[model samples]
Target: MGWRIRNGMSISIWNDCWLLGFPVRKVTSSQSTQVDLVSDLIDMDERSWNIDLINPIFNEADIESILDIHMSNSNQNDILCWKGEGSGLYTNLLTKRVSISNFCPRCNQSIEDNTHVGRDCPYARKVWRLLDIRWSDDASNLCFKEWLLRLFMTHNKGKHICIAVTIWSLWFARNRIICEHQYPLFVAIVQKCRMYLRHFSIRTHVLAWWKPPLEPTTKLNFDVCFSYAHQKSCSGFIIRDSAGFVLGSGFIHTHHITYVFMAEALVILQGVHFAKDIGITRSTLESDSKKIT
Candidate 1:
């Protein structure tokens, strides 16, 4: 079991089951009475674990697991969950199928299991290499659970989430190939996982307030709305002065956009052309979408 640290106020460093591995306990220290809550190891202002403060007290693997634990931005209480089940949503009933077959549909390999699907498979290894992860070539000896535990426990929260999503995406791609007879590109899988991670992180953090430009400069704020059902995308832009007064606004609707990023890029390009046509020489552009901005 592992603890998801939310507020990090109640969990103890030595006593609580927080870190990964068996019998969670902090490294022995001479000044043992000094430690208390897990929050003591985190920097409040930065909202990140304090490496300098904890480096001497924990081994590299333990420290990595401590850091890899996701910290919620919301003001929620700490919760304990089973770490064996990735994402902690598993149940005994879910494992009733129990297929004894050992064959990989993706690569037609003789052995197939969680470990082969997630890490040892050639396809899976390609995706990991594309993401520039430091995967050991001789890691075939480790079981699926052991491999994933070591892989995720060494990285930060964002990378951990990305890796998890990537593995899931790879599995989905494999299914699509086998069931739907559709080829899924490696780049597409990686991009999909990265986009999911980006959106997840954005949802966790609060948006900043829009600030007006200073002095004689004007600001151009552009946005795009896509209708997946209609296969069309529309863009709008508003030009505001230093005082937050709208100087001009324009809208354009177009068809043939393949994805949200394409639509956003089109809107930004159009916004620039619109600004130039309106003779707004001194203007700053802004967009709420991180991919666009």
Candidate 2:
């Protein structure tokens, strides 16, 4: 799985497969990035590539690939896609099922039935056990389909999703062993599943309603939009009371701002000073950035 960047907030800069044509489907020029997300490299307001920043950080090939990615003018978040395919239909993108050996590819000790390969196999059992969730590993009597049905009947909806992802990951591991003659480490497969889950976790767990500040204390929410190509940023903060009344608000469009975190920090600092100027004694700072607040 890979990302089709819209706002790029969801895609990782150094690790995700945003850049096509690369062997690992990632940036080869830089092994690490100061910024976390690919959105940091984009000029969000202008809806274009950050050319000045891109030229210096990435190799020529990667730079070209990044530039080729078109930016949508809409406010939609980054999209997760399979192989960055144009059709955007998962049904066609899936690998065609092929026949494999009757015996388990990894252990070769047991018959490779759907139930045995997915659960009873030594490798699959280890993969499930390594997962953070408490799993009932003794579903040996149930077939794969019945086992899934029982799991859904017992667990919550969230656990069902986790179980589905775990099964898919196990299938991937089994496929590798069958086709490539490669036995993936159980830990490695589990790590990939966790990373995939982490990406969705942010969007999935959004609050349905906002909780206001207590009594007289105000909430100061600060945000920043940065452009690396222009070396400029637009930051703002809004202060509101428990009643949702906007008490004070301000914004700044400035130059020479280089990094996303710097912009976020600056906005937060400026917000505090702004609140102080407005005579807001007791206030709670709020920001979407995990690094800043």
Candidates' RMSD to native: 20.4, 14.5
Clashing pairs in 1: none
Residue-wise C-alpha lDDT for candidate 2, range 1-293, written one tens digit per residue:
33546678767887666675412266778664556788888898898988988888889998888888766664444434222122211221113343334567688898766676667888888877787444465655776777877777877877766777888788767755643356889899889888877865766854235567999898988788899999887877777888776776666565788888888887877677666655788998887777874
Q: Each prediction's TM-score against the native?
A: 0.37, 0.37
Top of the candidates by lDDT: 2
Report the alpha-carbon TM-score of model 1 versus the true structure: 0.37
Model 1 per-residue lDDT tens digits across residues 97-158: 54433467668874766677677778888888888766565555776767777777778765
What shift in Å separates residue 24 of candidate 2 from its native position after superposition? 20
Clashes of each: 0, 0
* Candidate 2 minimal-lDDT segment of 10 residues: 84-93
Q: Candidate 2 — what's its lDDT?
A: 0.69
